[model samples]
Target chain A: MTLRELWFRLTYPLRQRRIARDLREEMSLHVELRAQELLSRGDVPDATDASLAARRQFGNATRIEGAARDAWGWHWLDGFRQDLRYVLRQLAHAPLFAVITMATIAVGIAVNAAAFTFYDAIVLKPLSVRDPGSVVRVVQDARITAPDVLPFSAYDALRKQARTLASVVVTTPPQAFATILPGRSPDEPSIAAARFVSADFAPALGVGAAIGRWFGPDEDAAAVIDYGFWTRSLNADPTVIGRRMIVGGRSLTIVGVAPEQFAECTSRKPSYPRNVPHSHPP
Target chain B: MSQQTLAAVEREPIPPGTLDMLILKTLARTGSEQLHGFEIAETIRERSRSVLQVEEGSLYPALQRMLVKGWIAGEWGHTPERRRARYYRITAAGKRQLERELESYKRVSAAVALIIQSA
Candidate 1:
């Protein structure tokens, strides 16, 4: 990245070679002195014999050289490869232990991967927004046995009074709803789960429609179809926007089409249409 | 007894992996005097009163490792007999490692001694 780092990387091998040469020379000198010591001590008479004896005492030269080179770093992968070979050799000797160890490791890895995927989907992954960290959920702690619910009055009060929140929108829990296209098969209506929200919901989530535009405050009876529903049911008609669709017996205009992966407020559910009315129960 | 068995019974070998620490200790004891591989082996053997004999096979490898670790520094020089040799002297890091190894060795050996005495 920098000139100094580039220089170091370029010159590293030369430095390593010098170190290796020095180590080999040092060991050679030691062996020579050892032979001389044997001669001086009268352990061996002939010069060649003493030198041979000293070489024998010094053990395998190639193995020691390999070990000395390993100490200079950059051989970590080689060390790991050697360890793997050793493990495979041992596994060849004991097949059952190897199988059980492999099975255990496989199971451990599968479980860990599954848990990490679940965590990433639910908690680690942020909502698709301009700044997901700035998004906050406002919950009313009723301190009762029932689940926490924000009353409509309280929602309105928070929306009006809260200075810290950039925007406030109220959404109902998702429930099953059916779509009724005009003059479609009367016997078979397309069914889907739907969520109702206030006018500020889409803006607060900080997502724009893939086609057309989000429903504004005046468009109370408008709906935005999800990308999947638009493609699968409407055959991805380009002029689907401004088309009229009856949802729950109420004729509503399709104002926009949400992105394919944009599951409103959650990842697990399919990307279904969201209706933003002027006044909605919290 | 066979000659090999007799030799094995004659003197105990220095324990494995402690050769580096012992070499550092020897260099520290000699202070400024740098020791060649042979002298280091001899000093270790003598200091242990000949009870511990450092095999030439292990000594060279240990020295090579210590050199790479930068615990000890080596340079080509002449021995007392005017023989060319690579003399090694302990660095500051080597002295610190020697102190740590000595402390741990003392504690472990003491614990072993206590257990043996109780048994």
Candidate 2:
């Protein structure tokens, strides 16, 4: 369960009593006034018989109490239930009209839901990382294209100059390449893609390996294999770290394996890429 | 009560979903005077010329619903007859609802009458 749902469930018990008491008092007041009304009418001389007759004429107290309780429990939902019943009755009188109206409403809701889901997935959902709230993407406003990419030099300058940022890492656009395992045949290369990042990429993203350690500044020639790549190519071998692999005609040591959900960028890239630094760290 | 008196006093039951509107109309007519449950029922009965008696069962439930919906507000007060009672007053929402319901009812009844007269 989500933390919010758990918290609500934990706190709900404290408020339930107050809600029940308020409902009881409201219903009790209604019954009391009703009895008084019956007594005032003076049809029956005895107060007890008059009150009883009034209640009987009013109908089942328990059933009305239950209905009122349901309203209190979920007010909007109860109203919706009543409205739905009314609509169904009307629809029963005119089946064709009901069909047409229901179809129109269904299509409208489906289209709206689909659009909202797409927008939520692409724009609203936060990145899957620790402290995602603190992570901010740097975009530069170029004269040609608004909010264009920041140059590596500018990024480096920001990394050095900015005091507010705990850490900043630059990620280069993904490039397609071929991988060749060291000691394997040269003709047996596997096609892959890679995204070059700065030394603090993993730390800045606040992610750690599921197995083995992340690359340090000195490990410029190291590569981190994502869980998907590790499972698909290396068969998820526990001892796959320290192995050497060649990508883009460069040999690198496998230092770590990223968690399954970790994607280097939030872009809609079909293939996950191994994260490596651009050239070597300064 | 005699059979003729009983027959005269009794009328068709009020249709469902219209009780709240009728109660709201009754309260609105009272202009600033908060009416208790009995008084509201009596006002509706008298206005309808004793043809519509608001029973305790339906009246109280409708009142509760209206209170929950924020259409009307109620408070504990003493009746002019010196009895402790819960008096309900029409809120702005209740007034608006009464006007809307009254308009719709008029239109619907007119249409229904047209069909019935033709038949």
Candidate 3:
């Protein structure tokens, strides 16, 4: 559309009221003139009869006014506004129906939103890990897709024959430990949650140490602190690696600080990781 | 004693789509003197010798459409009796439209006349 046409459409509403008023005024005047014409021509005996006859001959004044609005290209808009106002008045007269309708719509929207959220979180959004499409937790069928922990011998056998798959990781529930850090009071040891996992857990989940390397396979007493725990309890100490910390009255070496993103694999983030042998702890 | 009370409906309704032409022709013939809505309707009726009727509904909408199309311009003025009224004047475009419509109307009506008479 041309700029002038756009400008006219934009400004038309401002002129619409005056134009509509003028049309009404002109139509009424035409009726009055027709009535006077009838009276002057001796067609009717009285002014009242003449006026009524003139109006009848004029044919639906309200409809003519509406058609005039249509001629100016606002018929539908004016009609819709009038309809909407009428609907609002009717709705005001029946408040209960309005409330029930509004409530039904709200409940429908809430259900749809909640269902979509769950679908997105569980099905659409993938787990945040490197090559996550290639990784999946194996669920056993002892009780219909149960997450039963596998024995070390079964895990080892599967690991040997699964040449096409990445390394398998056996993760266990986190255990609470009364942890005492160096230079802190041993009496008021903080309760820290620590995860136990196979040595291959770090490489399998693509976890990298923020400070030191992952503890060696033989270092069974060493532990790796999570990034969040390192920052909250240890102030992100750079040289804290190789330091000995007391856990459950036993001293264990602080081997590494794992990156922050590693915490997303489980429901609750572990404060630190304690290495378990390839076999489950006796 | 209006049109309804008259015998046999003497005034025929003006043909559709010809209202604009009649309105424009009325304004064009008057030249400098701008006529109001009532005057235009009155002129058409008298010119047709009371044989043609203009419904106010069709008349006002046609005038409005012409105003929007730049064929006619309207201004609010007072009648001789000091009554407020809208006066309309034909524009150049309206004159051109009147000539076109008149030519077409003459052609069609002549064709109809020839057919009816021949038949």
What is every candidate's C-alpha DockQ against the true complex, given to 2 decimals?
0.21, 0.15, 0.44
- Residue B116 in candidate 1, Cα distance off native in Å: 25
Q: Could you say which candidate leads in DockQ?
A: 3
Ranking by lDDT: 3, 1, 2
Model 3, residue A42: displacement in angstroms?
Answer: 3.1
lDDT of 2 by residue, A179-254 (tens): 8854578799988777777777787788888788778876667888777777887788878788888888888888
Kindly indicate the candidate among 2 and 3 with the higher DockQ.
3
Worst 10 residues of 2 chain A by lDDT: A264-273
Model 2, position A250: C-alpha lDDT score: 81
For B1-119, candidate 3 gives per-residue lDDT tens digits of: 66465565488889988899899999999999999998998899889988888878789989987877778989888999999999999988789889999999999999999999998
Q: Model 2, B6: alpha-carbon shift in Å?
A: 3.1
Q: Over the stretch A1-282, how does candidate 3's per-residue lDDT look in tens digits?
A: 436445555677899888878888888898899899899989999999988988998989888887876765766787899999999999899999999989999999999999987677656665556677788776566764335665567677877788877788776667788889866877779888877777777778776777797876777888888888888888988778988888777788888888765654444455677777775541
- Residue A219 error for model 1, in Å? 3.2
lDDT values, one for every candidate: 0.76, 0.72, 0.81
- Per-residue lDDT for A161 in model 1? 96
Specify the CAPRI tier of model 3.
acceptable
- Candidate 3 retains true contacts at a fraction of 0.76
What is the C-alpha RMSD, rounded to one decimal, of candidate 3? 7.6
Best by lDDT: 3
User: Which lDDT tens digits does candidate 1 get at residues A1-282?
Assistant: 436435544454679777667667767877888788777877787799889988887888778877766555557766788999998999999999989999999999999999998788777777776688898877655575234356778788888899998888777666677777645765677776666777777778877888987888877677787777678778888687887877776788888888754754465433344556546562
True contacts kept of each: 0.38, 0.32, 0.76
